[model samples]
Target: MSPRSILFFLTLFVLGITASAQYTEKINSNRPGTSQGAFSVGNNVLQLEGGMGFGKEKHKIFDTKTNVFNFDYTVRYGLLIEQLEIRLNGRFRADGVKQTVGANEEKINRSNFEINTLGAKYLIYDPYKKPKKDTTNYEALKSWKEHYKFRWKTLIPAVSAYVGANFVTSDNPFTFPDDPAFSPIFAVIAQNNWSTDYGGDWAFVTNIIVDKVTTDNPAIGWILTATHTVNDKWAGFIEYQGQKSDFYSDDILRLGGAYLFDQDLQFDANIAFNFKDTPSIFTFSFGASYRFDWHTKDEIIEKPGLEGGVKEGEEQENEEQEGEEGIDGEFDEIEGVENDSLKLEKTPFINTFEDDSFREELEQDLDERRTEERLERERIEQEKIDKKEGKKFKKEEARRLKREAKEAREAEKAAIKAEKEKQKMIEDIDAELDKMEKEQGVDGELDDIDKQLQELERMENELNQEEKEEQKAEEKKAEEKKEIQEEDVDAEYEKYQLQQERAKKEEAKRRKKEEKRRLKEEKKRKKEEEKRKSQEKKEDNENLDIDKELEIIDN
Candidate 1:
């Protein structure tokens, strides 16, 4: 093929490859709802997307070469089975063409519109398995799955065909067909991923299109494209499009990038060099798309709660606070003492009963007090050990209760599952029994089996109902336990607040006593200073008197 012819096919190939991949009949296509089979499979999804672009279009010299502006859109929906998929594809397009006549003739313009073509595809084989674990890491698992797939096109693999009429305005200069032209197109497309989870990675795709124009004795034309993604978003491709006759051909090579924002939206842009020979044509084209889905699915996990400890702690704090407050109230009931002696004695006095000893004796008593405190501390430590053991016992009881409840729940679920399996088995057995009866004459053996199956099914159903009732009882018990826990937490929080209040009061009392002691010491130190100054003055006076007396005696 001539370079121009090669460019032409390349351009057509680019169009096919860039078109929406949805496999459903576009409502706008002239042939509406025709190919209504499965076009895509694997996920039940629906998508709507469209694109508009401007590019140089060249026809035969005498026939006229034109710049073509076009807009197209498609909507698709598909069913995705575990290993199979079916899809419905649809598309529509409108084209504006400017053509030039021979010898620098003025250009002629025309418009054509087409819509509503349908198609479908089925995955003959897909190499993937259902996830076996609840926490299957899809990212890691994806690498383990096959990267290739085989599919069957209900009609033809990777082909989009639509029929529509082209109407030339009455004022147009070029000769045109009086009747609307029928345009039928067929294409084959292939796509594969290049080892990346992110779709921006490399991809290889190609397309082949065979088309028949409505006019000119049903002349045939074809286009081919080969595109390779150098990376996730950048791609390079070459295209050739031409009719069988030497009259029409164009070759083009394009380097472009497709920005896939997500599975729902995509944008593509390309710069093309057209080898038309007469006047080298440069073209830029851009496109965008949006996809939609019908049904969406997701998974959620259940959670477990903690045993009740915070509630107990809070209750303990509250009791301590209450006790502190009671102590404060009792201390406040005591008469306030104002004597300087009272201030001196503000620190808690060791009870000085009639038999209390002197200072050295007090010191010895203090040592004994310290020894007693040590012994008391040791006893309290032992008591705490015993209390901790008691708490452990209570904790064990709580754990046992929880375990029993859990076991009850598990048994209920097991019974339900067993019942379901039994029911299924009974159904299968009945089906087999019917088949055997149909094949053999009605016999006592078949009747006996049927009776047995029915009895077993009834028993299973009764057991399932009983298990369900027990499950309900357990659920009610759990709910009550939860409520009790909530109440305990509330009570504990209240207790903690009370304890904090009582601690604050006790701290205030301690601070007040310290302040009084500080004031008493200040008063005592001031008194002593005044006394020392007075004594010094007296001694000076006495010395002056003695000096005067000695002087008199000498005279």
Candidate 2:
């Protein structure tokens, strides 16, 4: 093959291999202590996490004390499922090597970076099932209580499991007398975790990783770890890490505790024992890490069915079920009781008072009160009746007085009318008299005129001027008297008009007083009707109270 083609194929092969092993995700599980599973996407979650520690090794190389450090990281995800289970697995490791100390024994500075592991994990089971309580009785007792079991609470179990491939890249330079050029290591790991409760607060986890190294190395080994969560956020772990590489084998036992401040941040401390050496050596470690909780979308909300008060409801249901069973068993016994000489314990048709004497006393008191009330009511009714009779008498007297006054007014009106008629007749007679007198005066004047005419004729016959002048003066005097009489008649008519006006005003005053009396009578009648209705209503209420008293007595 051409070199170019070979290089292209090699690149493709490398790319494929890298693509298969490289984990791309938003969550990093290795940043701090984590539960079993990786954070994933969609219906599943994927998480990548890693951490490394560096410190001086306990070993000395020919009195040239050396320092050692380790680095490790892993990534994984979990598939969502309904059953209380999940898959879990991840890879990680610890590495120890030594670097020469400085010329001064008190101070040593060394730095080594190693990729301990790349792994994945899943959750296996929820360590604890959520607590549940039921509260069916709450509803049945609501009216009797002001406060009730308004909410129910419970906890649910959660679990997960996982498996993954692990690889470690070593950055070791062969500067010493005996050192390796490179250590290519590979591993396969399986892990499981179970959260006892819904919050993943408590958990039991176990993991094992088997390692293989391309180059024979003394450091590579199989690792086993078990962890228990003491609280929602705190965990203690014991781990066994041993190596059975082609060159040598070494084992280390570690006891550690981790506190999760959040999904992304943690603090850890550990005490480790190196068992492979002639005498076991102990080392102490303490570390703090800041992790971005990438699994923020993964929330553990308490299920309603597993809430705190849910057990009460469950208990109530159980009670009801037991009661039903008891009822069925007691049915025959209850039937047999019907034939017993003693009274059958059946539901009472009427509830008897527990303290019959007390009830009797109460009944007697009620009866006495009722009788007193009835007598009082009767007394009031009698008083009302007496008042009504008195009022009626007063009304009759008033009516009689009004009638008398009315009759007097009518009599007065009749008298006034008669007087007016008499006056009118007198006026007519006077008018007739005046007319007759006027006629007579007219006739007399005519006669006088006739005489004057005769005289005029005589004067005319004798040609007498003085006699004609006397006649003209006499006729002027007579016309003046007639005008005076007509003025007198007009004065009498004005006087008659004043008298008629006075009579009409008197009649109006009398009629107004009568109308006022009539209105008063109507108001009194309405008041009497309303009083009657009120008395009837009072009687009805008394009757009802009496009936209730009787019913109580009978009971």
What do the candidate models score in CA lDDT, each in turn? 0.43, 0.43
Q: Tens-digit lDDT track for model 2 on 1-555?
A: 234334433543333222211121222233223333222221344434344454434544344333434444443443343221122233333433333456444543434333333333333333222322233232332232322222211112233333333233344331222434433333333333322223232222223334333333434344444455565566666565554444444456677887777655567777766643333356566665543332322223232322222222543553474467542333333342211011111111212433445543543454344344445545655776798999999999999999999999999997787667656655755665565455444345445545654664564445335434644553454455456756787655654564476567557845765675566556556656655665675566557656655654454
**Which stretches of candidate 1 lie above 4 Å from their native place?**
1-43, 57-67, 79-107, 114-118, 121-184, 196-200, 213-248, 277-281, 295-555
lDDT of 2: 0.43
Candidate 2: Cα lDDT at 457: 53
Q: After best superposition, candidate 1 residue 153: deviation in angstroms?
A: 21
The local lDDT score (0 to 100) that residue 29 gets in candidate 1 is 16
Please report the TM-score between candidate 1 and the true structure: 0.33
